[model samples]
Target: MFDYFIAPFSDYTFMSRALWGCLVLSLSATPIGVFLTLRKMSLSGDAMAHAILPGAAVGFLVSGLSIFAMTIGGIVAGCIVALLSGMVARHSRAEEDSSLAAFYLLSLAVGVLIISSKGSNVDLLHVLFGSTLALNNEALLLLSGIASITLLVLAIIYRALVLECVDPAFFKSVSRFGAVAHYLFLLLVVLNLVAGFHALGTLMSVGLMILPAAISRFWSNRLGVIISLSFVFAAISCYLGLLLSYHYEFATSPAIVLVLGLFYIASIILVKQCGSFLMKRASLAKLSIEQPIQNPSSIHKGQSNV
Candidate 1:
């Protein structure tokens, strides 16, 4: 057990770094994910994930994979796309989801083209899938910094965020910070996506952000518990995924996401089964009560006939 689970981190520097990076990521990303899920913006997280690609790709082209360059470029691109999507949805005929979908698709294509033009298939793959095992001091610092900034900002905006999720119209009516919270939340999403891009790539980063939240919904309904559970789920997935990758030589990012996917599937199955069981019990109880009442009525009717 120790060799299988503990040895990897203890024996290998890269494994330890990967684990630390993933934990830090889960710290910030999972809560944002919970809020996104609450707001019914889960797909928006995915859209923004792809939307960051062009920026990261541009950074790659300019700086040849410098983490800072790609990160800045990705943040800038993600913010622009997010702002444009919101603006278009508000000011134009297209709805927010439609507009977001359109922008993400275009951003994805443009990003792929830019990366392919300047870099090899390997580089493109790195930008899409991430370099989990190759994280160094710079990448670690970036992840930590993003997580810290995200948590602090989230704390400051906690009330407004909750209000926005619970009742956007009401929040806007009562609080001047409604729009500020929305935009700031979007910024946080972009920031986390950019941070995840460094480790999980544009395609897979949102997995870290969204999947655990999805799983947590199966276990709890309270917002605080759900957020806490999500972080745990994400952390466990990261450990198991990294272990699988280390043992089987599977791609790290996909392995992590695959574990989360398995958890989601299991949660769905378990919830359905429990629900079915509860319904069956309720039905049986109802039938028993009804049967007794019917017997008493039949006895009364027969007595009257006699």
Candidate 2:
């Protein structure tokens, strides 16, 4: 039981790299996911995932098996899809979701068509879901670069992201950088999705991005609490999933994603009931409450008789 679980930890270069690669990605993606879900941009994650197919396929066609260059190409392509769909929706009264869905579906179809024309269906296996055991230095670098970019973008736009997530109209008035901030977040999502696809597969990457954050919300209402909990869960899922996959001989990316989804569901039921407030502080605060003052009453009956 402990053998496959702990075996990868003992010795293995690629496995160690894979561990770091996913942990970093989970750190960025999990927090962004909470924003996406809160903003009802959940579908946007799916749209971005589907939209990457074509770029990845095209990259494979041109670069053979260079996952680095190919994934960059895919990330760029997905960003294009995000920007264009947004532009179309904003320029006209047409809905962003409607436009996004169309673009995503089209991209998915085009990707399949391109992959079909280039070669056999063998690439589809790796494309749809990744093979983590096969991770190379190139894959590690790509994931790291995307994670770094995501964190930077978030830092610059953290307040705006929060405002937009809670109230877009208020965000527009208060933040001078609201529009830029919005697109930037979308851009980060595309990049993160592209990077995470290798570890979560095309279909499951969105879940990996969204689930852990959603799970973390059950335990706290503070934005900081949710974000911190999300990052921890993401890291845990990534490490444990990799360890479990190696031991069980299961697929790595999906296994990691599966563990995340499990945590999401588990938190939904369990964390909702945990209620972990600081007891000492709460007790002290309760003891310091002041009573409300009462207005003086007049003896109207006696005054009238006098």
Candidate 3:
């Protein structure tokens, strides 16, 4: 069992890159994911992952296998889609969800169409499903660079982001920092989303983005604890997924994603039980206190009921 788990590590280069990518991806995504889930923008993460396609297609058409070109295209497309959806939601009198659904689905179709029309030389399938084991040096660098930038930006904006998240009205009334921070946050997310596409593909990337964070929410009421736990959970899922995929000859990205999904389900059940237990304990304590007050007459009469 240990051998199987350690097998991937036997290849110093291949597994090293994968593990590094996974760590960066988990670190960048988990805290951001916590915010996204709390903001009800979980679907937006999914949507942005898919929306990166058109940009990727265009990049591949021009630059072929250049990860730099591909990343640029993905970030551009993601930002446009996010901004457009926001604009449509604000101006068209349309529901936010409806607008998001339309833009996200349309972007995906358009990406496929562009890829189809341009040429068939590329394996566009991998973009949708990811090829984690095949990640080259360039991909590792991209993941590293993006992760560093995202973390730095997130650190700078954490307080403001928290403020906006908790008190948007108060923030809006006082400073423009919230507005700037919001867009910057989205930009970092899109950048990371592009990197994640290489590691987990669009379909599974959303799970990594939101699932661990969602599960972490159950164990922590404090933002810092939830964020930390989320990162830990994501890291474990990545390693487990890689080990399982290698052992079972499974696709790495999907395997990792499925592990995260399993973790999320387990968390749901466990968290609910924990919550119920806390609530029950509180109720029992309240009842214990109230009993003495309600039965003052019994106390005065020396009537003790067990």
Candidate 4:
């Protein structure tokens, strides 16, 4: 039994590396996802994930599978989209979502065109889908480093980020950290998505950030608890997904994402039903206690008769 569960990772070096990469990513990216979900910018994160593709594609064209080149390219592309979308939303009459959608769609087309024109179909597949099973020391190191930087930045800016999400106008009034906080958080989002793209591909990277956060929302409303739960959910999904991929020969990234989807569905049903049950029980108890109090004369008459 132990070997059945543990041998795949223990016996295979690649499996272990894959586990480490995903676990680190889960720890760092899940928190950013939580913030994104809270700020109601989940779709924005999805858009930004696509936006990084052209930059990464340009990097690929220049360096040909160089991790650092692609990463830098992705970051530049993502930040450009984010800033442009924000600018358009502010300066023009277009909504933020519409502008982001337009930019990401354009970026995706441009990225695919560049890759297809300069490189092979395989290269295009790599950029769009990623190479999770082929993760090496370099890719792992890049993921770990990004995770470390993300955690540090998030720790330093935690309060400000929360304030900006909760009450942007209040944060602006109290200090000049409003725009700073917003941009810093967006930078963190881009960093996380780029890191995720290395493992999950541009098409699916946002799933790692968004699904665990969405799952946690079903279970808890407290920020700290929700954050912790999101990490736990993501880690569990990674572990299970890797195991499933190993055993079934399924695509690793999609397996991991599909497992997260399962968690989300289960959380919605179980957590919501549990909450409803508890609320009903509490209401029943409260009604029982108040019934006699509201009809004191009837209670006294029954007592005297008895």
- Report per-prediction Cα RMSD to one decimal: 2.9, 6.8, 2.4, 1.8
Kindly list the per-residue Cα lDDT of model 4 for residues 12-114, writing each as its tens digit.
9999999999999999999999999999999999999999999999999899999999999999999999999999999999999999999999999999999
Q: Cα lDDT of model 2 overall? A: 0.81
The reply for model 4, stretches above 4 Å from the true place, is: 296-306
**Model 3: residues with Cα > 4 Å off, grouped in runs:** 118-122, 279-306
TM-score of each: 0.92, 0.84, 0.91, 0.95
- Model 2 lDDT at residue 203: 78
Candidate 2 local lDDT, 162-206, one digit each (tens): 877778888778767888888888888888888877766687788
- Decide which is better by lDDT, 1 or 4: 1
Query: lDDT for every model?
Result: 0.95, 0.81, 0.85, 0.93
lDDT per residue for candidate 1 within 1-306, as digits (tens), equals: 999999999999999999999999999999999999899999999999999999998899899989999999999999999999999999999999999999999999999999998899999999999999999999999999999999999999999999988888898888899889999999999999999988888899999999999999999989899999999999999999999999999999999999999999999999999999999999999987897676888767778999
Candidate ranking (lDDT, best to worst): 1, 4, 3, 2
**Deviation from native of the Cα of residue 259 in model 2, angstroms:** 1.2
Off by over 4 Å in 1: 282-306
**Candidate 2 runs further than 4 Å off:** 1-4, 91-94, 272-306
Top-scoring candidate (TM-score): 4
